[model samples]
Target: MTLALYSGNLLAQSHEWTNLHDEELRRRAVKAAGEKDLPALVSLTTAFLTVQGKSGVLTSPRTVEAYELGVRHFVEFATAQAVNILRPGRHDAQNYINTMLAAGRKPAGVHLKVAAASALYRALRWAGATEADPFREARVPKDPTPGIIKRPPYTEDELADVLDRADTHAKFLLFLTAHAGLRISEALNLHWDDIDEAAKRIHVRSGKGRKDRIVAMSTSLARAARHYRGLYAPGGPDHTDGKRTTPPENVFRYAEMTTARYHLSKAFKLAGVDFRGFHPGRKYAGTRLLRQIKDFGRVAAHLGHESVDTTRKGYASLAADDLKDDLAGW
Candidate 1:
């Protein structure tokens, strides 16, 4: 059947397209795109992405939000230029790119927006929305500086000071990332069952890129784990109070990443240290391990990195003392 016939039937069945769930919207979008029904295609795709966010297709909520913003920006630009959003020519796409660069948007930010637009086109094409992908060959400048130069890792002493100022819960959170090399999300989602204290190993399930790895915990991390478990774990010796409180499954009780970050930031404030972010703690772990073992491969494994080059490029940086020692020997 023609897309027009399908869209008419779809509209007749549902007065408000926005009310449909992601799956329903997805089906409608495919049909609308196939039929080349401009109004229905625009409405269904917008509703599918902005509201419910192409759930299974997109990896995270952050990506969904970024893509939605990117698409909105592109639509606005197209409208202002009297260009069709779904069928913009190369000239129009180039103009948008030039406009963004002229406005002094950072290279990374521009890349993200362009990538988001590219993703939107991909989805559309998959659903038979359009044959052209303007973003496919668009150029985006690269950020020349290395990540380590931008955000250096926290020193051992600095992390220690933050730990000293932190509460028990906050301390455990820091230990997971700084000492055990867990990502902030991994630490926040960690369950008691994932840890093998005696073995000194942590099984990280579904880390970045949907991959899992075994992370070795440091002595300090193990100590912190035991202490946290005693007071806060589901069935620990000191966990019970007078009333019956249903114990939480995850180790850290904070339900939101922002809340966890707030506590960590407060500790940094009390310790009189700058808050560079949680990833630096993970970097600290990687650098410290590399220093001890003199092996990039092991450090990469510990950091759950699929490539050793990533660990070397981003995590491994020479300590000031190490650099000085090499010069002193000369």
Candidate 2:
């Protein structure tokens, strides 16, 4: 396999290469790939991968592996259509979509693969490889369309029981995610510098779009954060600071997503909570915060959402009490 590296535009540096219009660029990119220009192929693949990473879609290494699988499928389709991977035409893309649907791939799965392929073509075009976007004309299947999957939230009683049963770290993370409405990635990437103990705020420097925002911390979350801080303090026994005198940059080291999920799941199980995963912790958190604060704008800001509409879409489930109150009026 030819190793792909990301270096903006590779063909620009080649003396034998000539910059062409979109039409000719598409033809040349396909011709060069047919001739097996390893560097060109690598550059094209790397460019798309880089875009995926930047789009906040590829959050973990596992997701990247899945993207690679999608890439492989696209390459195979392009080869079968006798087209270059970078400039497969609309007909080729449409045919590939049909083939995938016929192969019994789930609509959601097919959509993801198609989106990845489309992104790849866009990147190739951006890099001056293609003229037209093949995906623009590709006919994606309409039925069984993919949509966002939202997990159910834990009940208030169940949430309390889980917190009551959780260990210090698990409890802390739970409160941070549940009450504070921090995404797992945002919470994991948090450092000591991001926290303001006196002010009871956490600064999110790099979030979904690399946007920075400050979120208010709950009292319980503040206390737990301080406790976590003590664990990393110099001379606090777990510290690696020389003479235990200096602080580390990060509060948690090598915080794997799997481990965090396992611990939270175990805690929920022990507490007899019905939740099967950690995302519900966030869902419940957002819902509870909205109810307690009764301010959509505040909840959106706390959750780092761009707008209140997004918060409502994700967490606006009516409670039994709400239904009961409405029925009373009838």
Candidate 3:
């Protein structure tokens, strides 16, 4: 136990992820928060992300992604209201929130943004920010819309057609996500060295929730990787004679998110399939896995969701017909 504790302390020191006591954390947050300029706010926002990441407070990249979006929204509203969010009052917060509700967006989604903003406030305060939480007195009206939100996954045939039409890189990305349910960031961060062809598994580093886990890759995915590596090698189509022109560490060379979106949109168009956005692939994987096992927990485990309810909320919106066989069994 002593040795293990020592090792744990060493690891924490190496990564600096140890959470400071409330007082010290607040001091650092306040130091980062005092600057109200755009650049300072941006830096503070980034600092919040870093502190959360190091402290294991952030679980998923999506959480970070959502926080970044919320911070941007907060900053814009602060600028418009002539208030610094770090030093905001109830009035400024209400005004900013009013715009969100006025836009006719659903309340649940808006609440997420508000929640993120509140989290930033707490994070800053812990770091020593002296400002009052503007959201303390604010209210986000409840959304009356039915809690269920569902989208149909792409059919196997439609997905195959998309793959057939996709460029090599896009094909790999789309196919992997469809079969393995890898989030786009996970897919993009995939490194060749992480793939275990023999075990048919890939280690997803710091996936959603900042947790590392392994997911099985299909045989076809391995084959596709090998084929792409060959083509993109020194003599392959993507590279020239330059040594520095070696294949990138990432399996897929595509980096721009917009470009991937455009490719998916175009592929769906050419394939004559209904486009339900890139998320359908993940939904398809989760739904199919749930169907086969009839176990929500198992399916959620594969998808890296800590709670089965979250998996159900996000991916359980299936059609009545998909359950015909199971219903018959009953």
| lDDT tens digits, residue span 1-330, model 2 | 543322223234322223445566566667655654545544454434544336432344444445555665676666666775654554877888888889997666788898767756665665566565777777766553212133467777888899899876688788878877778777767777888877999898767666889888888888888887777643455666343222367555536667778878888889877655666777777777776666778777878888777777665443547556548868
lDDT of each: 0.71, 0.66, 0.66
How far in Å is the alpha carbon of 152 misplaced in model 2? Answer: 1.9
Report the Cα lDDT for residue 198, model 2: 78
Error of 3 at 148 (Å): 7.1
Q: Candidate 1: misplaced stretches above 4 Å?
A: 1-83, 91-105, 236-247, 319-330
Q: Identify the candidate with maximal lDDT.
A: 1
The collision pairs in model 2 are 235-244
Expressed as tens digits, the lDDT of each residue in 1-330 for candidate 1 is 122212223233333565666567557666654444545544444434443343433244344445556656665566567766557777777778888989988776788778666765665654444677888777877777766666679988899899889998788898998889898878877778898888988999858766888898888888888888888787775455443223467776664567888989999999999988898998898888888887888888888898988887777665557667558868
TM-score of each: 0.74, 0.68, 0.72
Q: For candidate 3, lDDT tens digit of each residue in 1-330? A: 011111122233323312566666555555545443433343344455555545443334355456656766776666666776556765887787889889876677788888767766765664566657878888888654323353566777888888888777677778667767887777777777777766877798957756788888778877776777677643467644343322566565555456677777887888887777777888778877776777888777777778888778776455558778768968
TM-score sort, best first: 1, 3, 2
